[model samples]
Target chain A: MRASAESNGGGADDDAAQVMGDGRHARHVTLKDVAELAGVSVSTVSLVMNEKKNARIAVKTQERVNRAIRELHYRPNALAQNLVTGTSKFIGLLTDSIATTPFAGQIIHGAQDRAWKQGYVLLIVNTEGNEDIERQAIRMFLEYKVHGILYSTWYHHEITLPQSLKDMNTVLVNCYSDTENLISVVPDEFNGGRTAAKMLLEQGHRRVAFINTTVESPARTGRLAGYRRALAEQGIAEDPSLIVDAEPTQEGGRAVAEVIRASGATGVCCHNDRVAMGLYDALRNRGIMVPSDISVVGFDDQEVIAAHMLPPLSTVALPHYELGASGVDAVLAPPVHLDDHRVLIACPAVHRESISALD
Target chain B: MRASAESNGGGADDDAAQVMGDGRHARHVTLKDVAELAGVSVSTVSLVMNEKKNARIAVKTQERVNRAIRELHYRPNALAQNLVTGTSKFIGLLTDSIATTPFAGQIIHGAQDRAWKQGYVLLIVNTEGNEDIERQAIRMFLEYKVHGILYSTWYHHEITLPQSLKDMNTVLVNCYSDTENLISVVPDEFNGGRTAAKMLLEQGHRRVAFINTTVESPARTGRLAGYRRALAEQGIAEDPSLIVDAEPTQEGGRAVAEVIRASGATGVCCHNDRVAMGLYDALRNRGIMVPSDISVVGFDDQEVIAAHMLPPLSTVALPHYELGASGVDAVLAPPVHLDDHRVLIACPAVHRESISALD
Candidate 1:
């Protein structure tokens, strides 16, 4: 790649080797020498430095290039680009919670990976589950003059955003806003629910139960709607008695099983994996065998519960990392119109041993 | 409490009230007035604002005080103290991941709560699980002139902190440095292991098994030590035959369970709740009844796994929130001597129905 381009420096391969005139110390190595030392083209060096995908370079060649760069202490001039753009090369990430859930981490990881590849860094602030803190965190982001903002909600809740940010470039993650115009990247909970229900239906189960929490929660409501939609598509009438409202707790799951049993449901679609875990307890307490007596499906596909449940829970998997990454992406390059505000990430159903064909 | 304090708005209270007059805003309604309106004292108001314990103030009085403050539109000039000290009223929170896991969010919540009470706001940077991103994050924090830095690792890894921060006040959470004299607040994995092991032993189980991942992992090593320590204290020999290495995955748990069956161990302690979940699947696959046939305990108390496991998993809880809160505290306070730099928080065990006495 370097051989194709006209030289900005003198035409030698060692063009980047000159020391500074100030004589304070040796001159810093640049991308040119790294390419030269690794016997690769300059574009190859850029690709390696930028971590760009679709490179036809061999793995061994890439490793050698990286080793040469590391050994020479070559630094990419990302700061120069920041100077030209008058941007801090930073994106502000505002979350209701930062350290407690695995979903947030996955999202952050996705965003961060994308941001790094795109030459941007993330500035994160936790709002401590308070609206006031959330407002203040945004103000702080503004003061730092971040290029963009990604606001991530812990759960689906109505957020009263600060008016100061009304004109700012922003995106919401795993949340929706009443404004309708704002960009939002959230897990496709409705689709996830529909998928779970479809899977159970395909197994020849008609008497399906929906174990969920309060209807007041947007997530629960959305999933319920999706479950109903899926059932309707299959020419099955909604069974009100099969719906159970359980607290989003283990005890709640265990208690809700009584309702499931009373409704004579053969299949159960849990609000989340946590609820499904509790269902396991309630099922075992009554000497019911999963898949045989009752097939269970959960949502969120939490790493801990999905792996550990007695039969291994089959659940709807939320792409946490993708959600986070997309949230940041939306902020960086939002769709132009309010009608295109929603970024729906696919939530695939993970097939574990929790569900089997109905006999 | 307010009535007495309003009558005694002497030195400190008066100073605080006057501080609000720096701008055109009127001497903001002092905490004294709120106390007076609530029939409490200024000190009582201070206690509430600081979230201090040992307060005997009635809930009604607290609500009254809060109402008065809201009605008066009182914005506390608490952050002024930070400006005087040339310290940014903002603390820098550096995390490797912000959106993937729940632990970081809980820790951030705890720290944010404590910091807000102390009149500090957090400026968050998400490194997105990249070492280069982390370096850049630290540089940004330094450029922004943050008062202190709280560096949190997403997973257990030896961290190479930014060299520029050698003189700055820094604290590490959930990760440690190879360098001496740096303060770190990490989960008490050893204590957690001991807690889980002791609980299982107390349930009268003698034939206990251990399923862990890589021995190189500090968390696994610490937990293994605690398990052995607990066994030694109880005069029980540590059985090599009962120890199995399982991948930190559900599939690994299934493979380990076959070994567990061969060893004839009646009780099991897992490296983490995730591994324990795998064990659950393995046990169910073999048609073994938990507690009746074998009792299992896990570590990390991952919410989903702990609540959802068939019997409700009994696991050692990591003090993630406390670790985050304490990390902020350490950075804010004077540095402790490197030789004496050790802060260990207690990890308590949560008892569920998973374990039963082996009589």
Candidate 2:
């Protein structure tokens, strides 16, 4: 397709085995073979394969070419076509430990599905936070002439944009950049936290406890604000005593159970499912049953933990798939400034049996 | 490098930006530019870059070329090098659903690490079990002239070889072919099962119950045999009544807990960590404690479930990482016949708090 006339020197219908650059012997069915079989020129076959509307070819000749192609099973060379078309149909996805994280699978899945639908393929590189590997991977992406790149992370966080990626069409997924040079798709943490709080409030629990994670993150601040807002909407004053900070783990949940019990709260919102699980264990140890004694809700509906809990935990989904799909859309879409240079995907509330209506 | 004389038509020392096929404008410093800066021929620069032994260039000239390379930040174009060298330093990895599976991360990580160590980059395609995508991906791989392919599955199982892969150099990872046409690296299920049984046996538990999954698989059959073998080695007759079969999940663990308890077994080995977790819950419900009442062992040391259990699960590792690394080795190795056309990686035993020595 890229003026490869020199490649047609091999006699038509030679049926010769081609030795690939990789030293693999492959019986390549070249355009010359099909053209010779159809009694047409190589350009005619290429035009037919590319379906060029501008090229005027006789219907009978086109039919002959099609039949030859079917018989020989000629697959047009994508690399050669790419050279002429000036598009590789490739999108590079660079992730910081997405493959190793169980919940992050949906991101790749969503990105792959959207890329496939758009007639592109994703070339993924999991950097595992190794800066050297990230830089080398970027060089490889440049060599491949990838159409665009989707820089993603396993969790929502801010990252310093790699200087090398500045010249490329890059979009961040489940992560953002401090410099707003590139667009990004991240979860709406504030609303996700609000939804977790509302789940308990709608069950008629007036006194709700927000067990925030001690680690400083957008989730820590956003969810706390959302929880307070939800209480205020219900004519309940924000009580600072109801907010407790602990590690965002099962152990953290167990450690905070005594404090929660002493506060006289009817419902509690955990930072994540792991914390809720720890709370469940501690409550059982103290002979305090969930829902009946203290209705609980969690964030991050991690399927394994949340779904398999004694009573499946009600939580908020992280919108990983949506973030991935949106990142691809942003990278492929026409270059335009987005509001705030970011797209906030909603974290949906998942209702489970962890919460019960108050009498 | 292959004869790329045609590419040398451009004038040297021209700082012109090259428009890539993907329409990305990149300031690519060419070999000619480096040669011009070093006051040497382009061929000499290439010889220095490739470190050709036969080409005796002056040490002073080599230093000059190296200095120019460092100053200009010139990177050899991998695509051009691939075209001339007849070898693209790219290994294609095609997986059925590794991206979505929780435990399959190690496979990609291992393969990526090994490939990088060998100066090769991996181009992965997660087909998600889609035949059309798989076929298309293979065609793309062929067009790019990949050096080799590693066809992997998320789990250790048997699969039909894709017809198109017959001519290509492919090695199966965590999966095998019934036809035995291609070499494969799979986990030693028999040894993995044996390890699980031995963990309880070593704790002086003679009457050990094996809670196997009802689903017929290599794991079920292999583990059962291994369990019986361990008992036989201990001079204990196999007790058929002690073997219970249920689903492979947590629910499956709960369903068979009663049978395990009724058998008067002091120790039990479960199909997986999920089952072990479920058994823990069911045992607590029945006022039976783990290790104190009935020592437990699980398979598949799934960190999240196994480590987070009230008492950490003692189980066997699946060797996912080893299987993946072995697959890469097999593909890159010289074409030679392998023993039985397969490489079985060992599954190591993981000791945790779930088991206790008898007093």
Which has the greatest TM-score?
Answer: 2
What lDDT score goes with residue B234 in model 2? 90
| Candidate 2 total steric clashes | 2
lDDT of 2: 0.78
Q: Is the docking of candidate 1 incorrect, acceptable, medium or high quality?
A: incorrect
Residue A108 CA displacement from its true place in model 1, Å:
3.8
Question: Residues B162-185, candidate 2, lDDT per residue (tens digit)?
Answer: 998877778888888878567788
Q: Fraction of true contacts kept, per model?
A: 0.25, 0.29
lDDT of 2 by residue, A212-234 (tens): 99987778888888888888889
Candidate-wise lDDT, in order: 0.70, 0.78
For residues A248-268, write the lDDT of model 1, one tens digit per residue: 766778878888888898899
